[model samples]
Target: MWSGDELDLDAYLARIGYDIERDGELAPDLRTLTALHRAHASAIPFENLDVALGRPIPLDLKSLQAKLVERRRGGYCYEQNSLLAAALERIGFHVAGRGARNRSRGAALPPVTHALLVVTVEGEQWLADVGFGWQGPLEPVPLRDGVRVEQDGWTFGIGVEDDGIHVLRSLRATGWMDVYAFSPQTYQPGDFTVLNHYSSSHPQSRFLGQVVAQRPGMDVRRSLLRETLSLVRADGSVEERIVTADELAATLEAEFGIELDAEERAGLERVHAAGV
Candidate 1:
């Protein structure tokens, strides 16, 4: 029920690094999905800037959508995915949120969970994620299994787990790596807030102690993490480097479109010092 005036849509597109025409034109199916994927890669950077900087990250829809689209900023999964959901809904797509689970930093999974989104396009269901840094998906993948799929030059596959849930993984040089698991359950916005609170405010949550980000292009992916900045090209060559504190700040602004104030900078310095 949020309305994006002309200014709002323009601002939102700017935040995500998109330049879409605002007239009443609807994107064709492939173009719609592609735009969604690219919009996610460019506009909503995978980041926990608020938590690391000791600020209260709002979980409300309007606030999040405004920050990401209207103000031209980046956010973590909850923020990014949520804003993407809103935009998709605005553009005539049916969407739903779902619960998920992830380990904190290098830790093991919580006995409980996290949150994600399941989108319905045409007659196919796809996984739409705007969060999860570095390893995040570039295009919405079919929520089915037993077949290999490819996008943005990377191959992915889904299969049934021992527990009967759907599992996804990526094919890498070494081998396949597990990305996440999901079920066919339907979910809502309220479900997401619960998971977001646990992930954002819990002391053991790695978002408070570490930094992570990712961006996508036609055939490459760029990721900025706690101690590494890497670019994975279309042909699978990965160029990486360790960044200094100054470089980290620069990357946030230059790549993610986040504008951190002086106080936020001091807070980020403390997070770097803590080093998880």
Candidate 2:
């Protein structure tokens, strides 16, 4: 169970720009779930600057609220999904955690390093993830196998393999490409803590020595990996350019909506320069 009672519900709703008066009453229904999921995904970015900065990534509700909600910053899967799980639970929805393997990198069998959520509404389960970076879902995708949903212009589908592992795929120009896959096993916060350690600190972790930030939108998706900034449009067009250390701070704020403080900016700049 996520620690929902300890979260600042008002601040979180406000941070995501979800006004109860305008959006709708807070209820544990599909409408409310989709609205909140979309709002959160569009509002918060996905970044691993803390990992690159050599800072500890805490999973507690208070720390999550302080660093993500209050600070208006972004985080990777664990932090983003954990914060969302708390908010949804606080709103009276049934939420559970799941571990997933990264499949974007072709032919590589990585460990289960991704943390996502499965929310039940009216006895139906939905895959709600706000932390998959640029390839994440804007709204919850139903858990039904072979179900496909379109959000704005992007399309996502869910399929079950012979081993009973559910895979989430996206429709690229080439075809349906695997995004990530997870089993039916339910993971706990402590489980994510273990996974987070490897992701944030392990030398082989992709986030350890690089600056990564991503924002997924209806028209375009932006990704800042180290010094290269890439933009992919809905029509399958791609544009990329290198970002210098001098432009790192501005690029983060402008492209990914992540505004780092003085110390973080300096540290990230150094990491970017070294990585380049």
- Which parts of model 1 are misplaced by more than 4 Å? 1-7, 17-24, 27-30, 103-107, 111-113, 162-164, 234-237
TM per candidate comes to: 0.84, 0.99
* lDDT, candidate 2, 1-276, per-residue tens: 799999999999999999999999999999999999999999999999999999999999999999898999999999999999999999999999999998999989999999999999899999999999999999999999989999988999999997779999999888999999999999999999999999999989999889999988888899999889999877789999999999999999999888988999999999999999
- Cα lDDT of model 2 overall? 0.94
Which whole-number lDDT from 0 to 100 does residue 179 have in model 2? Answer: 96
lDDT of each: 0.68, 0.94
- Candidate 2: misplaced stretches above 4 Å? none
With candidate 1 superimposed using the best TM-score fit, by how many Å does residue 123's alpha carbon deviate from the native?
A: 2.8
The per-prediction tally of clashing pairs is 5, 0
Query: What is candidate 1's TM-score against the reference?
Result: 0.84
True-vs-predicted CA distance for residue 103, candidate 1, Å: 8.0
lDDT of 1 at 141: 71
